[model samples]
Target chain A: MRDTIARCETTAHAEGLAAGLTQALAAARDGFSPPGRVAALPADRVPPGAAAVRNRLAEREGIGCFVWPGREAERPHHVRPGHETERPHHDGASDDTTTEFAVLLGAVRLGATRRLLEHAVTHLSGRTVGGEPTLRKQLVLGTVADVMTGVEAARHALLTGASVPDAVADTHERLTELDWETTKLLGASGYLADGPARTAHVSRLLADCWVAAPGGTP
Target chain B: MTELDAPLRELRGMCREAARDLRTRALAVDADPADVERHLDSPTLTLIRVASTPKRFRADGSVDDGGYSGSCLARVIAGVELARGDAGLICANTGPSLAGVAVDALGSEAQQEAFYDAIADGRTWTFFGMTEPDRGSDATAMETRLEAAPDPADGMLLTGAKRYVGNASRGRIGVVFARTGRTALSVRGAVVRIPAAGYEATPLDMIGLRGARICAIDLNGVRVPREDVLGAHLPASRRGLWGIGRTFNVMRTQIASMALGVALAARDLVREERPGWSGHERVSARLDAALALLHDAAVQVDHDPDARRPPSVAKLHITDLAVRTTRWAAHALGPGAMLEHPLLEKWCRDVAAFEFMDGTSNIQRLHITHDVATRATAPRPSAGRVTTPTADRVTAPQGAA
Candidate 1:
């Protein structure tokens, strides 16, 4: 688990969020178990590009289930979480979200979140707005620093077991926030439909399905 | 709480009533952006079109609710109500919008008439292009240029590209800011009409607010006549940058109000979908406060046309609040609620549109912080407290040294 997180983070830091998320999505397949929610498993488990992952829900034709390759017998499929096109579960389907899946979702997105932060730093450093490099603005610098602080704290929490019961879910929520703050640095361009912000948005949606409420049962 | 005068209250009520039709068309527009064309005849959209146009240009005559274009307060009242039905659809609707505000500020009698006449068809869309491919919202750094034609009779030629522009592809007539020289004063707005040579627009596939059809435009030597240049009669001081500031101040409040409306819509969706959910009261309370802030900002702008911080602060705070509210609505509806409720998911996407509409939150922060610094640097004369070179203290606690 540590090696996977390390590898994904390293790859993301070296490359970008797309490459990092690609690595993270790959790790999502084998080790995690969703409690009957929209499992955003890659098509045929080939792990498509980050853009493909971001547009996964859009591409789907209202079929909100992913069938794992080897587990077709015991668990035929897992429904997608509270999607706009989601179908109601049968009377017997479970609603309890597993903490293990939330933890894994946190790990998968952690590297990508860091990579997004890196991009923000690089962007803020090179650009100037209103006669100053936005990085020199106290507000912009503060937000970037805050995001970095969150990435470090989340990394630390993942390395050593957290004392909080739902630490992973909390981490996921914080990362989502930090990710948004980082995206803010890109100004209007960041909000583009196909921009890096959508990757974080897709990650948040993925987290929403798997991460249970902080006090909820595992 | 905001205390609205009777006329404003009536305006809000009428807008609220018109919002129902807007809601009906919101989903359809989301499904297919081109669907907006089919609904051009919708009573609500028609009323919006007339309301947005200036008084002299309104071929449809005076609206009973007065009009939304006369004041920032009026725009906020109408904007919030109209946007509650669907902010995305408001962007989808073909009307004067920001361009009208710009013309109202900078255009001469003939220019305004020319501008209004172009969009009188109701079907024709209008666009305002300022953000450049590399410059974003830094209007002063605009690279789009207006250079002298080989023959002066042909006037100047416009060349450069703009990205993230609304109605870029659909607009038949619009305004694009371009620099004729290197200085800030050199930047100018030229009234542009399309189907003209050297103008190309391509719609971008936006993840949300598809109805707005945010697009990229490439202007390769588009023709601009001498009279078509905005602020031609005005001195250089009241030209491009001045109009941009005043226009942005008004648009910011409207954008912020629309964002509040979207948040209200998101919260209401939770109430409708999860009927028994008592967890949304907090959301409702926050929205109420945001409405007040939006109204206050509008009132400030109406009183002081050049006021920047109020509108900037309102936009910066409300845009983030609206986006958060949508997420709150999504979570309140339980897991996969977005799948079960299409409107909620669409609101989630639509709310982000407001942040980039006029000025981004970062730009707003700059205006706000600069205002704060100015206030701090100049201590109030009526205050009684210690003042230092680095800080200003108006009031301190009882035990303060």
Candidate 2:
């Protein structure tokens, strides 16, 4: 975790760290406050050090990050000390079981969602699996989907002080490339089998999801 | 009385009333084919009758409010607009109506007024007898000649055949252009209106635009009165290239507008039938795209009719789009649309016909290339010397005489 923090130097990097920090803080029961004075901190702050490396990473990747708490009243900084961060205590054995159940359930949900999306995209494209055309389609859809997945994963990874901005940006670049590829394919298809509609729908879904993902908004 | 004030005002009111009545009838007969045809055909005849009289007066040497502001011009334009509103009607009456207008434009003032009064009274359909059997695009190469005799009593004798002479069979007056001299340098345009007995009109069968009755006219020694000559009663100047250019510009834009109307009708048909198809999603998107392109082209020509190259380009683009879009709609609608229904098949034929009408797509391309190349190589005029008028010829009709 300290190694991850040592790599980040920007606000996006810090917010990435904050996301991981959130999970860690939740685990540790220690109230987590981002370093630096709250009032003076930029809206999107990364941790100190690795400035040159972080800038290079941002350029290479397409990630950008901005903090968007649900409401000003419920902001992390505004939470009351004793009243906030409360969870019902459980017996040790029950707590462990609950954690295991949560992990397994999350894995299953993610796997199912990925499979459904893959099936839908393949059906829409009318390309055979393992063929050159299908392979190309898969590459485009996978690259975009993976970038979105990475952004989501980075939020939790930030608990361990990972550079969330770099991860989010890299995913964004891949997503943009995927969008271009999809539109070109659809245009070339001469709109066979409702290709334009499918292309438009997927583009809109990806754009919306990208904006909503942690450290992914431009 | 002023030439057209009362008559034109009356014509305007009648046209508006007729147009309104037709629109109501069209909507009421939306699903009834026979009723729609009846409603469309009647108003069309009325308009044609109104338009045809002007040409007869022009041929008889009577009306002369020089060219543009003449009562004949207003009546002709109004008739064209009304005819154009319904494709079936335009297909039926345009040739005869245009024949009348053409005579007024190119005929002698005395001939003009005579034809105008005749057409106004519904006595005759005037024929514009310019096009020859062999000379179509190249009018100067016309073999038909008029020979003048040295003897004063002999007068000028017109010999040779004219083809594509609209309203020739039934017209009382024929405005024929013949080569008074053989050589290209000696080519001259003469407007001669022959009595029906002096000339023979043979109807020519053509594909598409079935309603416009076209005929090949054979003028054999058709003698005209010496005073029947248009514009000072002298031979037309061979160096009048500018007049030809202006005429081409106006005619091409008018044809483009006609093509636009047909394309729009096709689009409406497609929209109506689209929802029932399995490929509705894809078809709708393409339909939207095609409509946008058509609208852009229409607006460009409508806003600047004299922009020259854009009008031809728009005509080509819109006509091509219409052909493809209608073909798609036909495919989507399946066998039902493929049948002799009013919507798809006839419209497809109409669009295809329009593409070849005023100028072929190839000709339009050549014009565009030539215009571009000429502009590029030509010396630039000083800034203040080059002025662009804000008024568009299409929207603001000129009152020139």
Candidate 3:
């Protein structure tokens, strides 16, 4: 399992979390069970990229891609028009949630978040402000290092599985903070409706829908 | 917190009453920013316009509210109450806002008249262009260039682009800062009238503060008459950086006050959502303490407008606190709070704007640390508090005095 996670992290660093996660889901064998031991919804209920605990068991059966309503995605697992019944897929089918999904999603979101920081570093280093590279400024460097530290902290927290509810909640907060801080480093570009900020924002909503509370269904 | 005297206390009560109208229009503006135009005449917005305007320029020429415009402290007091109503709604209102402070500080008698007169009609929107696409808040590194006009009689040619400016597309008139030479002193502000040749502004798609109408501007040799140059008659030293320093110093406290107000609003919403949750005790106590800190910063600005550290500390702390408080509001409302409560969701979005408005948290921290490093050892930030009404006398002339 750790080897699979490391390989996905490498792919996410090179490509993206979605690409890495999709690859892992596709390659896994049919007999495999996700850590959560959670059951899948009906096949039709899943999608182009739903974050359900199903991994390539059948056609288009890769686990990935949780998108809520009114948000952007590469391949949206959206609520169909007049399909209110399937909303638990978007609004969180907490009952279907499992500790394993939280553990896995944390690692996945961190991988994506780390990618955002790399993008920010590239943007800042490429640009010059007041005759100096923005990335070289002491304050900018300090902020970058702070976010790097956060990624580490979040990575450590995700490695542990004790207290599923608290771990999930803490992971959610940590990754979201790192994402926001990294976005600010991109300046006005970060506020664009698309790009790294959008990805980070989607990751936040994805966690909300997938992670469960102490008394939640997961 | 310093005890509010009767007049200031009464002013806060009136603002609290007026804020409900801001809440009434909040969701509508967020849904459709253009809808803000239809609701601009609410009592709360009108009061803000009147209070922000100098007494001599007001249409009614009445200072009915106690010290709403009277002092930095008074405005800070009212800023908190007004934003508590709906920060987005306040940003949505059409008035001589962000630009008004700069014009008041830097404009000459004739220049000030031109600015205020252009926006005399309640319907007119205004813009203050400073931030650029490449340079976030580093105004000193501005690339917008102001060149000599072909014909000296035409004054100057202003050519530059600005981004993240409020009301840029809709503003009939505004002030944009540009550089005439390599030196910082060469930086200057020029007022440009819209509907002229070679000046265009396009609204940017925003994640939040949709009502703010943030935009990107393209200037192609926009003509600026010599008279429109702010601080044209002032000494070279005071023309550029000085007024910016003064404007930011006074404005920071107000920004902090409004940010604190949003924090309070989020706290109240959590209470409203969970009627008997004692988990909020720690949050409430912290908010109360932040309010005191905000008031202390306001007093400090009133006492010495150029004091940078107090405002920096206040803005940095409260901006992040407001964002954190809104997040707490979501958590307290339980899972799917954002999906369930539209207002809380909108607030979470709107609060992010304050973090980037004047400066980001990183920038604010730099200011605080830079100032602390320069100063000798001193009392704590909250020390030497001045509670007297007279301490609020800095901007009193605007109060129909």
Candidate 4:
């Protein structure tokens, strides 16, 4: 069980890194040049690709537009009514963006848990504890069923969180606990660093989840 | 001990038996989406067998044992029971049953013999081709047209298309709703044989209820014999506009019953998996309230066939509860809920259809509010309370009353 969880977690981490690198490469191809380099250029002087990327980021975050100096642009205004001037007009996350982020976190969490359950099902079905399959098999099967139920709850919370404000926090908390429980179920092999299963480790998945989670450390 | 419970108990038993029968097949259409695509071309016989059970159908093509009027409520109970087993199967069962009710209630003696008799054996299927791409619950706005054919013997020529017509691809016969004139108010029903010339059906890809066999039906000047016209010989009031309404009167209840079945199934699973869920005061309270509303709707369906408000109220409340109950079940199940539990996910998706099909929950609300407001103005001894006519009091033949 431990080895399987470690395998899943490693796989998620590698996948996340690959995705991040791909996005970075795409941004570079679009002339954003990554990091602090693009911010130094004038809005109009920026390459079309860079400008396009900026616009997409702005729109998704509910920043409305890249208001170069005093020039305001028409975009979906996501700024809260009272804090319009208190926050950066181009970087402020709107309620919609927050909900989107919550949903994204939920997706990552669900993917990891799905892998965990699949591993458990495969592993437990093949192996037995104490040289007997009956009681241990029942226990494993029952736990997996319970996990299935929890995943559904998390899914509902994630879906509702997309529209309901309070639901986001509820789903985030639910998902965080799910991640922990899955990791614990697999034990030391799940914590193993250099094993053949290290590639499937869940640390990256957990890290990404934390970064996306409400009140996340990152 | 109530009149409603007796029949409901029997219907429930039938539904459970059918569900057990399907489980034995282990089709797993719900667990694997690929099975849905595969079955689209060749529908599995599981649902057809369930629908055909001697318990559901009679030798005369009418539902066995269930009375003509009371059959509506009985079907509702059966739907609830079927839903508990598999919501996709409910779709398949109701697809034909919907057409049966319309034909039995509105078809001429000859029409009934041809259409109903064919399905009496439980092996045949019928489709209700009413929803068009542009028109749904407001079916009066349909674009499908039935024009007077050039030859009198050719009957009516139907042109235009129906989308989301359940069982159309595999049905032996279908009842199509079309505009008799250019005006929206001229809409009427026509029965067409699946094999008729210029008629085409294509299976639709659906998010849920894969077994329902939903399809798009196109009629390119499809000719229907005059005898196939749903209410050709009936009086104006009992045939066209009024006929469809009576059909809905029973259909709406059955739809609500299907939704209730999904909710009941969810509630049962939640109870079994999380036995302590009922111990939670708020959860128990909600369950009690939902069950009470469901039972109240069932009782109203059996006792008050003519009254619009009871069924409307029942449908409105119960469908909403079905969605909520499934969500609650998922919530109770927790993180593991994401695991593919075919029944839970299917029920959730199936309940969504109830909210949209027939008169939408919003439309039901509109009717209920209108009734309440209209009642508020009328002066009488039963002024505050609304009293519906008993089932026998209703006079219209079973079309849209």
Better of 1 and 4 by TM-score: 1
Predicted candidate 3 versus true structure: per-residue lDDT over A1-218, tens digit per residue? 56655665566567655665554454444432221212232244344454443222112322232223224332212212225474434333233234445555667677888999999999998888768998998878988999999988777776663235566667767787888889878876776544666666556544544553333321
TM-score of chain A of each: 0.67, 0.25, 0.64, 0.48
- Expressed as tens digits, the lDDT of each residue in A1-218 for candidate 4 is 22332332344334532232222222222311111111212223433443322221112212221222322242212111334475334322234543444344445445556665565466445533434542264434566667788888776666555556346645655654554344333422222222212212222222221222232110
The candidates, ranked best first by lDDT, are 1, 3, 4, 2
**DockQ, per-model, please?**
0.25, 0.01, 0.19, 0.02
DockQ of 3: 0.19
TM-scores for every predicted model: 0.84, 0.46, 0.82, 0.59
lDDT string for model 3 (B20-134, tens) is 9998888888777866777877878888877777777777565365566557788778888988888877777777788888898899988988888888777878888888888
Docking class of 1: acceptable
Model 1: TM-score, first chain: 0.67
The CAPRI-style docking tier of model 4 reads incorrect
User: Cα RMSDs of all predictions?
Assistant: 7.1, 23.9, 8.3, 20.1
DockQ of 1: 0.25
**Residue B66 of candidate 4: its Cα lDDT?**
32
Q: What ranges in model 3 sit over 4 Å off?
A: A3-97, A212-218, B61-66, B372-401
Q: Write the residue-wise lDDT of candidate 2 on A25-137 in tens digits.
A: 23332222211111111113433421211111122122222222212223221111223235113211123332222222222222223333344455435643333444355
State the lDDT at B211 in candidate 2: 41
In model 2, where do residues sit more than 4 Å from their true spots? A1-218, B1-41, B48-85, B94-96, B149-155, B182-194, B233-241, B274-311, B340-343, B373-401
Please tell me which model should have the higher DockQ, number 1 or number 2.
1
Mind listing the fnat for each candidate? 0.26, 0.00, 0.23, 0.00
Q: Number of the top candidate by TM-score?
A: 1
